[model samples]
Each structure stands twice: as C-alpha cells, then as structure tokens.
Target: MSNYPKTALVINCGSSSVKFAVLDPTDGHVFLNGIGEALGLEDARISWKHSGGEKTETPLGAGAGHDKALAFLVNNILADDKALLDSIVACGHRIVQGGDIYSQPTLIDDEVEENIKKVIPFAPLHNPAHLLGIDAARENFPNIPHVAVFDTAFHQTMPPKAYRYAIPEEFYTDLHLRKYGAHGTSHMFIAQEAAKMLGKPLEETCLITCHMGNGASVSAVKNGKCVDTSMGLTPLDGLIMGTRCGSIDPSVVFFLCERLHKTPQEVEKIFNKESGMMAVSGVSSDFRPIVAGIQEGNERCTLALQMYAYRLAKFIASYYVPLGHVDAIVFSGGVGENGPTTRKYVCSELEEAFGIKIDNDANYKARVYMGVDHQVISKPDSSVKLFVIATNEELMIARSAMQFVK
Candidate 1:
C-alpha cells in the first residue's frame, strides 16, 4: 500500500459512454478526466487527458461493451504513464444499483462482486455495465483494490414508508423489489455544498437537491439524511429527462403491449432511450436545441418545456410537506448546473406555493459554467434559499478510498 500511488481511479460507465477520472486520494484533486463513447452502434472511440493539460483521443475497438472500452481507455490514458497507473491504489466504481446488499462504498472481492451481480435483475440496464467496468479495471490492475460506490448508497437511510410501494409485502420480502433510489451520491454532494454556501449546518438544512442531467432525480434531504427522493428503484422513475419518460403510470406498459403491439423489452427501450422531451417535442435530447426552439415559436417545444417544469415543481413542492419548513434548494448535474431557464422554470411556480423564488438574470449568468461559485438566486426576503452547487462524486470516491488504504 505504501508503494502504490496515493491516487485512485474512478470509473462511471453508462450504457454508451465510459467516464474515467484520476484523483489524488490525499486531497481529492482530480488529476484528469475523460470519456470513451460507443456511439452509432459501431466501433468505439477513446479519449483522455493528462495533468499537463494534454489530451488524446483515438479508436479503441468496435462494438464492445463497457468492459472492453474500460481496457482500451486505460491503454490510451495510462499507457504513457505506467508509474501513474501503478500508483492507483484503488478503483472506485459508480454502481447504479446497490440494493440492500450495500449501504456504503464496499471493497469488491469475489464474493462482493457476485453479490452485486445478484442485484442485476433489479437494475438490468445498469448493474451489468458496472460489472464490466470492474472486471476491466481488475484485469489491468489485479493487485489493486476495487470499491463499489453505489448511486443508491446515500439513500440507504430512507425509512421503510418512504421506500416501500403500496404493493404486496411478499414482493419486497421475497424478491427485494422495494425502491432503491439512484443518484444518492449526487444528491448528497449537492445538498451538503449548498448548505455550506448558505452558512447553515448541513444537519439543519431541509434541502431539495435536483440532480438534473440527461438522467434526472430530486431528493429531499432533512438534516443531511435522504428522507424521500423522486427516483425510485431505477433512474427512469424521476422527472421527465433527456430520453426517459419519468413517473408514468404503471399501466402504460400494458398499453404499450396491447395498444402499440410492442413487447415489454421493446417498450423498455422506448422509455429508456426514445421518450421524454425528445419524444414530446420531436426534437433532440440535448436541451440546447429544445431551448433554442422555444425562441423560434415552436409550440411543441414550449409545451414539452412546460411539462418538464410543471412536473419538477410538483415533486419539489410535494416534498415540502414531508420535510417541514424548507431551508434551501440545490441544483446540480448537467442540466441543473447549466440550465438556468429550466431551474428558473422549476422554481417559479413554487414561489406561490412553497415561498420559493429565484432571479432569472442571476440564473442565466450563473450557468455560464457548471463549477462556478454559489449565486444567490433567491430574493432577499424570500423564505427559501436557492443555489447551484457543483457536485464532485469522483472526489467523494477518492476520499472513501483513502479511509480504507491505511
């Protein structure tokens, strides 16, 4: 352990993309970050950066899943710096589904890895990709430790009522089908940072943290513990996002099968990939284009945008009752950090209901970049505070790794 680099390698593997980050464990400083994409259903492309501000990109292989992509990513990113790779004492993987098997970041071994695989049925789209990332990293650095930093770990504090559906208890007891919320790390990081900016003790801040990226989720944090969250068992169960149709009635699946004549898996593909604002406005998933159309008199885009805001506001307001008096609202992730109009829209309707309000001018200007400072969007007299906090889950992982290295 003393000989290994005091650095930790972090991997976040999505369905089509693999994002890697290297951080100094002692200080949680990101040395460099990069992504590899398996786009167009063809050969994969890889890219990475060095701390010297040098970046490199190339093709790794074709049509391989995340595991192969991970191997190729290491080859291109760390090949020139064998010493750096050797210094990576641990690998922290961002797993989408932790289920009841884990409540925090756990060191991965043969038994732990097998247990993670057992939860695959609970998160079919996510768990497999995570395993691939783990295997790839282990294959390259077999002696190093690998830890699973679950997206659901931070929400493990959710009490039974908040997590359990109104369905039969047998399903939960026997099949473990209860809600295991995702995006917990993002919610935890954003909420704490927002509370810090407001000079409030994190445990005293009753916050609603919106992690709105391509995948979106809203969490209700009262005193630093997640009480309730928008995303249910999967990332697909939140507000309408880039490609996911969030919070649809369960019966919609039957409608897809009977009325649309599609099988369950086919319908799953639609909700996970083709639906949401893209399907509603008939525009691209990237909100930039959809927002541009808003200025071009596109009624469909306007309606889609309205639905997005209305849905987000509804959930945020609903949690106010469960959380008691709200202290601050925090926004993070791709859209939440940069989409001021979206954040503004979500906050506007809540002004009358939850005493929530934000300055549109500040929001638009604040979003010039994601990691910018805390901008006070709330009015001086407004009871509730609103903020944009940049989340750093990679650093969180590195810090967790440090706790174990000694």
Candidate 2:
C-alpha cells in the first residue's frame, strides 16, 4: 500500500453482506465501491464496480463469508486495478457497537479490536459481523493501518441521565446497561453535512438526525455531540423497523414468557424477527409495497405506515429538548432518504408544535442518488427546518482510516 493522505478504503459489514468503498479523503471523492452478499447460502454473488464504469462479477459459494469476500476484494478488486493498489493508504471499518466507551474514530489496534469483540454480547447481531470483516481485512492486507469508526462513536456524549436505565444502579457502572446508541456514524455524517448545506458551523448547529433503514434510529445532536437518541442499549430500543420490534414494553417479555408459555428465545424470536411492519401488515418487510398499499385502501398497510410515521414523529418531537431549540431535522438512510410520503406525514404531524411545513412538491421531486445530498422540504419560513440528506457512513469511515494511517 502507498503511504499517502489521499486514499483510504472503507469496509461496512452486515449480517449477510459486506460493502466496500475506496475514497480520496483530500476533497472527498469516491473512486470505487462494491458489495458481496447472499452469504451462508449457495451461489453467493460478489460484484465490484469502479468509478470508471468497469464491472467485475464473481460467483462464490455459501461459506464465502466476510473474510473470503475480502480476499476476493484484495485479490481481484485490487489486483488488476493499478490505481487502487498504488494509492491505497489505509483501511477503515464500520463497527456497529461501542458499548459504553463510545470510542471515537480510533486507530484499530489489538486492544481496540478486543474491546469491540467484548461488546458482541450486547450487539449479537452486528458485532460478530463486524469482527468477521475486521479479521478479514487483517488477514488480507496486514500492512494497511486500520481504524474503526463506531456506529455508536458519535453518541458517547449522551448524558448519564438520558442514557441510563432506571433499573439497578450497578447496571450503569457494572454491566454497561445504559444506552449506547448505534447508527451514530450515519447521524454524524448527515448532521455535519447538514451544517455545511445550511452554511453554519458544526459547533453552532443543533440537529436531530433520523436514520431510517432496515434498522432505524433518531439522535438528538447538540453542538455536534449526541445528547439523546431513540436507540438505547441495543438497536432494539428505538422506532419500529423491518422485522424487529423497536421499544416494546418490558412487561411484554413477561407476558410472552410467563403468561403465554413461550420460552425466552421463542419470545425474543417474536420481537426480533417476527414483528414490526412485517407482522403488522402481513406484507413484505419492504416499505415500498406497504407504502403502495396505502393508496389502495389497505387497512393493515395503512396501520403499519401510520405506526412508522407516528413513532418517528413522536421521537422527532421528543428530541426537541436535548437540541435546546432544534435547528433542523435531518433525514437519511434507505427509508429516510427515499420515502417522501413518510417524510410528509411525519413533518405534518409536528406542523402545529414545531411550526414546520414540508413542501410536498419538493419532497416528491427528490431523487435517489448516492453521495451527500440535501432537500429542504419545509416551508420557506419554517422555524424547525426539515432536511433530507443522503448519508455517507463509508466515506466517514474512510476518512477515519486515513487518520489512522497518519
């Protein structure tokens, strides 16, 4: 790898997919990106695309997990690609959980990697996946300095009163049961990006960033640090998501296990995999069809949409305090950036309280494109400015990686 400040590779790992991007940190230009998925099953398809329109597609087997995928990236994606290999300076990893430490973008050392591994229990779904990616990178490109940009990193500033649970006092100091929010990388990216779009300094802006994807969360960022967020100890503690039940009552667990004769695992399965929009609508987990059903007068679909929008609006309203006054409500991620209908409903619900008005015409006109982008869907004179900006977590990770090399 070249010792340079301009180039860094960013890796993002999911339960079944690993996405990568190569970027020039000097002026924030992305050169290449790719994804490998359909893991743990046969005929896994790995695809790589360069900024120059060159495409490479390979077919691997079910066991070609994240490590193997990275091997593919290094061997093929970087082999014939002279520019990528020549300029590659450092690597960055997108880690999903940081537990209590909420470490900022840090140079990934043995201790730091082990620290991430320790939180696997808290983030069973994501931390293990993150470790796999980290290990893969370590094995494939041992020379490249790596940095971990935590999904929880940006939220470490949350006050004890806001993040702590009311259970036992020891839970805070001992077990780390307090809220260690996730998707903070996305929140951090969009919030700072919004500051630029608004022509305001990051330290002067207060933002509530709503990251709506298969996983979802809303963070109240005050003066560039997260003070309150919808996500709690785990990603399960927020607004409703694809199949995950977000923020259910603690009593519901007892109701399922004690009263319904379901085991803890069985009850957990219900909440983590069998609930939310899928259970409520009885339709696909995707919001596209669910949103489509709204026009056709489908009751279940309508209720699902209502639940999603209402919860989002509720959280957005609650974040007003931590933000002091609330300068803007920034939306990003899959559903947040693309779902204008949902954005409309969410903003309209708070129109009276926040004096925010989304221009329906502008929202519907927004397109789906990558990189950083913004749209002010609010009335020209709205007090609480509403913005929908595309997120770039991987690029943020890349910049962190460059710092690691430095």
Candidate 3:
C-alpha cells in the first residue's frame, strides 16, 4: 500500500438492502465489495467478493436490520483485511434525496443528520435506510471521516424554471414541492467523462446523459451544469422504469380513485410497483426476460420494448431544447451500457431527425468496453455523437468524501 491513505468506504443503503464497497479512488480499484440484502427478516444474507477471489455469502441472523447488517459486514468481511480497513480515511454515503437544502457532498454532523431526517417525507423508504447505514458505520468505524453525498446535489445546478412546478408558489416555497431529479450523480459523472472524451473542458461542453436501468432518467447538461432532467419530485417521474409508470397524467390518479375505487395509497403502489415493463409485457419486470419474450414472438414484450425506446428517444429529443447544441448523447446505467438492442431502437428513431446515425458494429463492440471508460458508437459522419459510458457513482462518492477529509 502507498504511504498516504488512498481508500474510501462507500455505502449505498436501499430500503431493504445495503451495498458497500472498499475502493482505491485514485486507481478505481475495488479491494472488496459486497451487499447485505433481504434485510430485517429471516434468511437475510450478506454476500461479498474480494478483488481476486470468489464471492461468498453468509446468512445473517433473523431480524437483522440495516445497522446490524452493516455491523456484520464491517466486523466480518472488512475486519479480516486490516490493511485495507486501516487505509480507509473516509466513508461516503449515498443519500437519495437531500431536498432543497443540500447542494454538495456534506460532512456528517448532528445538523446534517437532522436535515436528512427532515427530508424523510420526500424519500420515505430511502432516507431512513441511509440514516441507519450512516449511524451504524459511524459507530463501527468511529475514527474515519464520514460524508453524505446527495444524489440530488449534482442537479442542484438546475435553474428555477426547470425545477419549479406550475402549482401555487407556496407549494414550492413552503411545501418544497418541485422537481428534484434522481440519478444526478450518474448524470454528472457521465457528463464529465463525455467532456474528457471530447477533449474539451467540462465548463464548455454540452451533453445529454441517459441513465437507464430498473430506474431511468435523462438529464440536459449545458456547459457542465444540469439545466434540466426528466425525473420529477421523485424517481417515479422519469422514463418508464422496471415497475414505475413514468410521466403519466396527474388526472389518472383521480380517475383510478373514482372509477376503480382505489385508495391513494393503493394507487401509489400500483404506479410505483405494478406498472412499467412488468405491467406492459405481462411477464417480468426484468429487461432480460422482456427482451427474451420479444425474441420468442411475444407482442406485449415487443410493444413494451418499443414503448420504452420511444419514450427515451422523445426525452432525448426534448432535452435538445434546453441544450441548443449537444456535443454527445451519453448512455449509462445497467441497461444503457449493456442493452444494445434498446440503444439501437432508441437511436433508430433519432437518426434522421437529429443527425445521429449509429454504427451497428461499433454499437455491438462498445459493450466490450463498459466500465469506467466509454465507447463511442455513432458513425464518423453522424452529426451528433453517441457514447456508452459505465457510470461509477461509488467512485464519485469516494472522490467527494475524500475532499472533506483533506
């Protein structure tokens, strides 16, 4: 190991899962990475893999919550690697929604913790879990500096016009009701990477970033700042996701309540958990199965894929309004980087309209160069360039956290 400390512990705690990684941010190498999942119930388990070893899984005890799960990870997996643990100088957390108060990675303090608690209403499932992870990790590794990296921090650069809702002013001013986009860290990272790929300064580059996965969102980055994004108020407002009904008419809720006799809670559940590709394809929420179904002559799956691509294309086109000229259209996240068919379909519609022509062979070859680095897929003569960049939210978190410790 180097004489100076060069590692950071990154924590991403979800509603029922805790994902942690020990990384060397300078070289982008993961010493150890793992996740504790199925939290708070029997059969809760922790699985992890070392850099050069096979993955290992162990059953956590019954009723293991986020705190207990993180404790087990630090005590069991990380404790054995004293060198790696000792080299870690900071801990970075992924806070889903920071509301309007936070705009950057903040050092964890009592006031910071309180503000995070205050935003629970905006991120009911995520904020509470993040608090658990933060509390547990702080206690488990008391000496290290801890930082809260808000996913909304990057999009804080969005102007009022882009983030504001059309409701009464008080709703936005008092109730804090407005668009606070998600996947901001991914979008920011990809935008910076795209700037580097173009050999231009980030402050002079303009780009559109598509972060597509189980949860999808697109952002318009003008001169390296987020001017607008697709997701609104919550992650549910973006492009159709694995299960979310993205960007539907607000009146649909009232319609469901009146005609279907569904409660508000029931309607929320349906929109967040029962819609999207799962409902459209009528098979599974996973894209792999949906794509497989399409190959097997399933019309519903075919339509689902088409609709997903269409919405993405439309969003890509609309973002151009904010960014008068885009240097590149970047694809990140799980599906964005790996789903060539989806990428092909999304670009096919924009080919003539946007002067973007995909090189089919280059698109297929790009999958081979997925993580950290990016691969360009648009033809040389195409007016607009297209690229597939693997997003590294953890690395971004680590980099932010490192600044505070320094």
- Pick the lDDT winner: 3
- lDDT-based ranking: 3, 2, 1
Candidate 1: misplaced stretches above 4 Å?
Answer: 1-5, 26-28, 39-42, 62-76, 368-373
| Residue range 1-406, candidate 3, lDDT tens digits | 3243479999999888999998888867888899999998888999999888999999998878888888887787878877777788999999999999999899998899999999898899899999999998899989988999998888999999899999998988889999999988899899989999999999998899999989999999999899999999999997999999999999999999999999999999999999999999999988888889989999999999999999999998998899998899999888888888889989998988988999999887777344435899999988888999999999999998999876
After TM-score superposition, the amount by which residue 48's alpha carbon in candidate 3 deviates from its true location, in angstroms, is 1.3
Using Cα atoms with residue i matched to residue i, what is each candidate's TM-score against the true structure? Answer: 0.93, 0.94, 0.97
The candidate scoring highest on TM-score is: 3
- The better candidate by TM-score, 1 or 2, is 2
Q: In candidate 1, how many Å is residue 167 off?
A: 1.2
Q: 219-240 in candidate 2: lDDT tens per residue?
A: 9888888899888888888899
Q: Rank by TM-score, descending?
A: 3, 2, 1
Candidate 3 Cα lDDT to native: 0.90
